[model samples]
Target chain A: MIFSSALIETAVNEFARMPGIGKKTALRLVLHLLKQEPAQVQQFSEAIARMRQQIRFCKLCHNVSDEEICSICASHSRNKTLVCVVENIRDVMAIENTQQYNGVYHVLGGIISPIDGIGPDQLNIHSLVERVQQQEISEVIMALSPTIEGDTTIYYLSKKLQGVPGNPVKITTIARGIAFGGELEYADEMTLARSITNRLPLENYMQK
Target chain B: MIFSSALIETAVNEFARMPGIGKKTALRLVLHLLKQEPAQVQQFSEAIARMRQQIRFCKLCHNVSDEEICSICASHSRNKTLVCVVENIRDVMAIENTQQYNGVYHVLGGIISPIDGIGPDQLNIHSLVERVQQQEISEVIMALSPTIEGDTTIYYLSKKLQGVPGNPVKITTIARGIAFGGELEYADEMTLARSITNRLPLENYMQK
Candidate 1:
């Protein structure tokens, strides 16, 4: 859309650079920022810049951190031997928010999407394989999304882990299909079929 | 959502403050930025800050501009004596994009709404009335949204303008009802009924 001012146009263009935001939405966001208090606007700008500038990735887990190693990697209470592998930091946050798994995470940065020109070489796969060999990791859980690329990454990682030469590390994937509290009838055909095949024993459910 | 880093959390919170953006969407946006190159992210942040710090409003029309007076107001070819009243700078851009009107614009900043605690004094209505008296303005076209507040603001401004001494400038509102390509069946009852009542003469339609 046409803006009366060049400054507004520039700001809007910057906002539209994001994945989902369009020109109209960008304009709305810029105008919203304009209405904010000057100090608040300053804080908004500085927060983004500071985060981009000062942000560090954990040397061990490859997760975002303020220090060399992230809190999850540093913490002794978490299960260091059972690392959950995810697509990105947001997935790490999602699993963390659930508070179900007390294990640490290994962020792959992204999946193996050949369509996007992202190969396994471009990911943190080498470091993951190294960590599996170096550390006495009992199990490596694949918590990536239920997509083709996710499956491919998991397959690639399992093969790599097997070739580590010493102790065999058990690699497993997160359960897929119908989500908790989801209606059986409302589920898609593939999910319903998968959930049925992957159903647990009735006694196992009672024990849990 | 739970974030391992406070910096990511802070940036996400700031993004969530924008209209229509939720915490999840904000997190997505922040993560997308984190994936970008440092220089591009720096440009994005600096653009917003600079725009907020240095952006100026037109002295004559209150439209967003980098100059003392807006480009439209400063243009010699445009009709300076005729002004189109609008709710905000976006509306000015919308009208200008059409290239149908040659007159200058007077931005009201916002429409008057008691529900939002916004009154006539909160808008730029006074300057518009003053402009009509000061300049050789022959007509003022009300181009606000077809809302209750827009109509209220128009009524308020007309009375306020009439209170001005000397030459009486004619006041008119942009035609409202069905759009040019809009279907009568799809239109709401109020708009469809209004369009039927305000039907122009056959000769006027043919001439136009």
Candidate 2:
């Protein structure tokens, strides 16, 4: 859209650069910010700028953090021996929100997507391996998604862990199948197949 | 969600403050930015900051601009005697994109929405009326939305214009009702009624 002002055009363009934000939505967002107090807008700008400029990656698990070691890895209350390996910090958050697990996390940053030119080296795989070898971790849960990249990364990690002489870490994947409240008829073929293959014991299934 | 970093938390809070963005989408956007180079993030930051700081408003029509008078109002090719009144600069851009109108515009900052604490006094309504009285504009087209606030503003403006002794301006509203390629059955009752009542002559509608 041909705006009367170059400033509006520039601002809208910048906002539109964000993923999923189109021109119309960007214009709306920019206009919304324009209506706010100058100090508020300054705060918004600074928030983003400072976050990008000063944010650090946790040395242990590679999650985005402001410290050398993230709170999750540093906490004594959580089980450091059981690490939930995920694709990114966002997954760490999702798992934490459930409050079902008391284990720490290892954020891989991304999966090994061959088509996207991303491999194990591009992710935090090396560090994860080093952590498993150096630390006293007993189990490493491969909590990656059920995608080609996720499976490849898990396979590669398991192989590497087996090769490490002193790194006798137990590797397992999160259960995949029909979700809670999901009907058998609506389940995808792959999920249904996996659910049947990894069928739980009758007594355990009936208990819940 | 428990963010490992304060900077990420602050940035995500700012992003979530936007109209349509939720916590999840905000986190995704912040993570996307984190992947970008610091220089690129700085460009995004500067774009918004510079735009807000240097943006100017057209003195006569209150449209956003980089100067006192906007390009549309200052152009000699545009019809100086015809002015299209709109609700905001966004409407100005929408109309300009049509490439159908050659007239200048007067952008009222917003409509008179009392529930939202917005009144005619808060808008650029006074300047618009003054322009009609002082300038040689022969026609004023009300290109506003078909909403209650839009209709009220038009009513108020028409009454104010009629009181001006020497200002003999013809005021007209844009057509309303079913949109192009819209099914008659799907149209709301009020729109269908208005479309029938204000039906155009078959020749006028079909000629072009």
TM-score per model (chain B): 0.90, 0.93
- Residue-level lDDT of model 2, residues B126-164, one tens digit each, is 888888888898999999888998899899988987777
Give the winner by DockQ: 1
Give candidate 2 regions above 4 Å deviation: A196-208, B114-117, B185-203
Q: Estimate the overall C-alpha local distance difference test score of candidate 1.
A: 0.90
Alpha-carbon local distance difference test for all models:
0.90, 0.88
Q: After superposition, how far is residue B64 of candidate 1 from its true place, in Å?
A: 1.5
Clashing residue pairs, backbone N/CA/C < 3 A, model 2: none
TM-score to true structure, per model? 0.92, 0.91
